[model samples]
Target: MVGWVDRANSKRAHTLAQIPHEWIDPNVINEMKERGYVNTREYLDSVLPQNEVRITALTATELIERIRTRKLTSFEVCYAFCHRAALVHQILNCCMEIFFDDALNKARELDNHLVTTGKVLGPLHGLPFSLKDQVNLPGIDTTIGYISRVGHKAVKRSLLAKVLENAGAVFFVKTTVPTAMLASETVSSLHGRTLNALNLNFSSGGSSGGEGSLIGARGSPLGVGTDIGGSIRIPAAFQGLYGLRPSHGRIPYMDVTNSYEGQELIPSVIGPMGSSIQDLELFAKLVIDSESWNYDPQLVALPWREVPHVKKDKLRFGLMVSDKLVMPHPPVLRALMETCEALRRCGHEIVEWNFPHNKRMIDVGEQVYAADFYDEVQEILETTGEPISEYMKIARENISYKGHSGRALGVSQWWEISREIRSLKEQFLEYWEKTRDLTSDGKPIDAIICPAWPSAGFRDGDVEFGCENYTVPFNVLDYSCVVLPVTQVDSAKDIPDASHSPFSTEDKKIHEYYKPEMFSGMPVCVQVVCKRLEEEKALAIAAVIEGCLANVEKL
Candidate 1:
């Protein structure tokens, strides 16, 4: 039998061979590998035809409008994205599956329907949509970067995929993910590592890194990613996109392949990633409008609600600079402070928020995430005799004891952990309620602004598991969180603080990783979090913040 590495290499070669020769640019490939970084958006602008570039840059809503007006046919929009996605695959290794022929055929059918009936198909008519490898599509294998799952085609489409397809989304490709979708970086024994489109040396941020990198590079305007612990938000933050990890019941998760399907203490939720806040809102509203609960009993029956328009002066925000577990690096700190200043100048009130028990919440969250000690992952690997990828090994180094498993807790112990999770949520709610006293308006803050991660983006395989202090707590509390890009890392302005003191060993390690030169061009984003299941309001508030920043930039 061939070794797993050889098989994995062969699989990657097959994927590369699928890209049409016309899209392959040897000069761009050599240039990207030589410089350790490449601005893909700029490179594509110079290489791709002017028409293709213009078509692919349009947002999802814009594409739908043009298709409806007969200004652009569905086939034209689909072909543009398919061509660009092929180039993205060659440069970044972000694609796991490509089916452009099928995509074009569907686009032609949509165009024929529109021309004959003179009626639009659906809200997302003719829009090119990408998916993470975990999302099941008919006649395609959702390997999700697992060598063992290779060649095992999905028998049916996942509920989310079906709904999106019904709503007129063209599925041309599925993006790469880390093995088991458990790591913060996108890599696997089967598909290899996915490089950041902005800087090849740094990570794209996973387990949804592929979606982030592709969208960031302008390959696709919209995509879907799942989050249990910051999977969606981290990738969006790293790539400077808008992502929402809605509370568990807001979106459907039926028939999705996952490592540990039984673990529901901190259940993973499906959400959307897009280039703009409007795209995010459209995705959530469309999915909710589908009434997914009818197909998946696990989903809540709540219909999409209208987002209340809160005036800038009426908005109250809590500013959390540090969680005391891991202080954000200077670039991330600057992004937070800059966002706060923009909001404050626009008449929003900002209050200091100190949440010391966030560390405890993260601890309980990890316990819930790894309750099975990765027995399921080992089982899958054993079936194909594939060695674990280096990224996954590094992610589990601190927790796993032996090669196959970690210490699994008993039922009673699991129950104890669940109770602790519930207790922490209650305590945090009380803390938020107490904030009513701190604000001048005498009400709890509408949302909190905090760092998405310690630094802008980490080098591949360098991400520590528990360092996501700001993001994981919301996941633990099942709160609605939106990641909004605020600024890019400016080396001169975001220099390290010389008088800073480390809070712990992890904090010291993170502080030492902050080299301004390494992260200079990467994006720095902040997370805006609201109470549980308040996705509509959270998205509206995020839009307000984004608008305020844009207005400030105009000055």
Candidate 2:
């Protein structure tokens, strides 16, 4: 049998070969290579046909309305996204699989249905949807960066996939992920590395990096991503996209392939990623409205709640500048502060808040995620003898408490850890409730604004350079979190402070990584979080913050 490396190469070659010749532009490839970093939006604007540009620019909501009104056909919408996605893959290496012909055909059928019947198909009719490699689609391989699983076809589709199809959504491509889905950066033996579309020098955050890159590049309006330890939010923050990580059981996780399938200490949840808050809400409401619990036993039967509109004058927000574990880099700190100021100027109340035992929370997350001592990752690597990617090695060294040879936790120790997690959750909720005394109206804070990461986006292979204390705490607490992009990295304005002291060794390393010249032009985003199972409130608050920022820009 041929070696796994050869198999991986063949798989990549096959994906590239599938792209039509007409879509392959030699000049674009040369331009991407000649310039180490090329912004996809500007590049595509200069080259793509006017019609394709206009079609792809429409938000999911706008596109659906147009299709319903018969101003634009489904074929036109799907074709535009497919063509742009093909280009995105060529430059960003984001897609692991592409089937534009299948997508186009599906679009044509939807258009025909619209013509024959006066009724609109569904809320997502004719929308072009992207998927993370972990999500299964029929007749496609959900390799998820594993070389051994490269050629194996998925016999069935994930529940989310079926739900989208039933709602008149068209699937065309699956984005890349890290090996075993364990790393923060998207790189693997199978698909190489998916780079940031905004700047090639930095990483597209992972394990949902592919989805982040594609959507950030405006190749797709909305996509699906999963998160355990900030997987979905990390990519969204780095790529300057809006993403929501709902509480566990809110969205169905059934029939999805994962690395550590049995671990429930910190259950992974799937949610939507998109360019706008409306897109995020639209996709999430559609899925919840479908009553996913009927199809997946794992889902909670919580229907999407329509959040009552809150006046900015009455809304209170908790501002967390530092998690006390690691202070964010200058750009992230500036973004947080600016967002707070904008909210305050809009008549919102801002209260300083801090949670207890953040470091211990990180410890709990690491132990739970690595509870099996990475045996699953080892077994998958051994199946094909594929070498671990450098980023994965970095992640293992930094996060894994025991060395590579350590044993799994015993049953008694596992139970103790579980109890500790339960206690921590209760304590966190109590603290949140206590905020009522600090707020202006004697009500708990509506949401908290914090840094999504220590930096906007880090250089490739610097995976262990920053602490995810901001995003991971919510995961452990099972609270609903949304990432909202606030600003881009500005070199002149976001310069490092020489007087800031590092909190720990990890903090020192992350501080050193924050050179203004290196991260200029990257997107800076903040995390907005609410109580557990409060997705509706979290999303509305995010929308409020987004609108406030837009008004600030107008000034």
Pick by TM-score: which candidate is best? Answer: 2
lDDT leader = 2
The residue-by-residue lDDT of candidate 2 on 1-555, one tens digit each, is 879889989999899877899998756757865654368866776678999999888888899999999999999999889999989888889999999999999999998899898877889999999999998887899998899998799988899888888998999899999998877889998888888878877789888999999998889989999999899999999899999999998887888989887788799999999988999899888889999898788788998888766633468988999988788989999998899888887889899889878877888887787777777887898889988677656556755544423568899988998998999999888888999999878999888889888898888767666456787788899999999899989999998988988887778878888889888888999999999998888899999998888888889
Candidate lDDT values, in order? 0.85, 0.86
Candidate 2 root-mean-square deviation in Å: 1.6
Error of 2 at 418 (Å): 0.4
lDDT of 1 at 550: 85
Model 1 agreement with the true structure over 54-112: per-residue lDDT tens digits: 99888887888899999999999999998998888888889998888889999999999
Prediction RMSDs, each to the true structure: 2.1, 1.6
Instruction: Kindly report which residue stretches of model 2 are placed more than 4 angstroms away from their true locations once superposed.
Output: 33-37, 311-313, 399-405
